[model samples]
Target: MTDNWSEVDLVLKTMVSTCLANEKYFGDLDSVVGDGDFGYSLARGFEKLQAQYDELDRTDIGTFLKKVGMLVTSRIGGTSGPIWGTGFLRAGMTAGATTELDGATVVKMLRSAVEGIQARGQAELGDKTLLDALVPMTDAIEEALAAGATSTEVVGRAAVAARSAADATAQLVAKRGRAAYTGERSRGSVDAGATAVAVIIEQIAEVWKTRESR
Candidate 1:
């Protein structure tokens, strides 16, 4: 029953803030096997979003998200830009002109975002990429809603699933992105992008829980 663009805006705002706050942590995770710029790049992109947030078109959820996607894509550095940007863009496309979003629509939007990321990054579920966490997170959200969970419960379950999946990436060898270049050396460390997803979801869950109480 989660509806309205303001709620969506709040979620996005939380995501942006979470990314900014975890910039150093994410960069450290990436440095284990990547170029160590994952956090920096993501933060820089979200910074632009934060800066222009108030100015974004609120014509509809779709329009607002599309603008955010475009801004992130153009501003973020390295490969993170296109990958993260595509996720947002595809979600926006799926949302279309909708002003209110139900649970089912939210799941659909997440599925579309995951597909877009897969296509854009040429990645799969076990690729040790963000998909590892994102796919499970989306699935958890769908399952939670199907089971009649409330908004807070749905996001809380998603956060747990994402965290578990992201942690499991430590056992996987990178198959894509800069981390892949490290071969077996990447097996010991978690994927930065996947970890970021988990952290963001956890923050969103907390925020949603607080919102629900009020």
Candidate 2:
């Protein structure tokens, strides 16, 4: 089964829950280069997600996601939230209720997501930004799909790629976010936003896999 709106909700819930569960891990790491609010922002976003769900009962994924995006932007005060908020909004626009979140959809959504972040944050791949992980995961998912892998397999591959890309950012100069202030010192330091996004996407993909297998 392709990932549906219900699956999207489940994935977001799981990702939010995982982020909350590992809040200290993200907070501790981000303290090195960020405001250390990644955990808080993510937790708030997840809580806001539940609020969005409660406020809106539309089965239309697009409507649901647009609302989600707006809520994230409003409730979460951070560059990451706006960046991710736009991504989710684009996803809603590109993907509707009839969509199954197939390989092509995932590729489009990922591309849109990165573009949305870049557009909002003025960041790019290799910029020690979320784009780093997002770019690679998108490519990996496409590759897995080209090889005829199932959604679960594609997600597994994407997750591996996301992890590698997140690690790679540590070696790059920060060109966006607070890390940009550190210049060369930013090198060898993983980006807080990238790491957070990596965790969210991988967790979401895993949830998607579980839905597929069920």
Candidate 3:
């Protein structure tokens, strides 16, 4: 992939792609428990973000990310939009407007992103939202970085953590969002947001590993 992104941009790209891909996933799954419009809303929001990416050259990473956040929250009707949007913005902010991100910075950025999501959504780790995956994944990144793992290694471990966390969320009863309406019934289902988070982070870490090998 010739589209190289710095720390913030790497995350931004992930958001854009995950939202787009989730349009289908959300449509298919949301039909089961919630409105099918989740896909349409996510598609429109990310499509608008496609235009914002062109402005990247004209702005700093943090500014660009915040703009994306604002646009997503403003356009998309669902909780997913605001949650992911704010997560990206907070991550960029944590990186301190830098152009490059090493292991430590990326770890901090991930943690900040998770905090942002929690602050905005008021969802805890067991809420069966994206936080279920993101918090644990970022926690792994932080611990890996503290142990002197390379950026690639930290991200790889984080991706694995994210996936496992996402899977684990299936056994949890939802305490937030529409899924919460299902009460105990939500326990066997995977959260759309958490699955999307794991997918994107896995892709990112995979790319990082491939880049390192090359």
TM-score of each: 0.98, 0.89, 0.86
- The candidate, 2 or 3, that scores higher on lDDT is 2
**The best candidate in terms of lDDT:** 1
> Which candidate leads the pack in TM-score?
1
* Residue 25 displacement in candidate 1 (angstroms): 0.3
Q: Give a tens-digit lDDT track for model 3, residues 1-214.
A: 1122555556567767777877888677655555667777877888888867776542555566677777787778778778867876886687555455566666676778888888899989898888898888878888887888877788888899999999898798988888788888887878767777788888888767776787
- Candidate 3: the clashing residue pairs are none
Off by over 4 Å in 3: 1-7
> Which regions in candidate 1 have their CA more than 4 angstroms from the true location?
none
**Residues 40-122, model 1: lDDT tens digits:** 99999999999999999989988888998999999999889999999999999999997999989889999999999999989
Give each prediction's root-mean-square deviation over alpha carbons.
Answer: 0.8, 2.1, 3.0
| Per-residue C-alpha lDDT of model 2 across residues 1-214, encoded as one tens digit per residue | 2555566667667776877777777777677877778767767776777656667646676677777788887777677678878988887777666536666876787677777878888877788877888888889989999999876787788888888889888888988777778788888788876787678777877777777778
What's each prediction's clash count? 0, 0, 0
Better of 2 and 3 by TM-score: 2
lDDT for residue 25 in candidate 1, whole number 0-100: 100
lDDT of 2: 0.76
For model 2 the local lDDT of residue 123 reads 76
Better of 1 and 3 by TM-score: 1
- Give the CA lDDT, 0 to 100, for residue 76 in model 2: 70
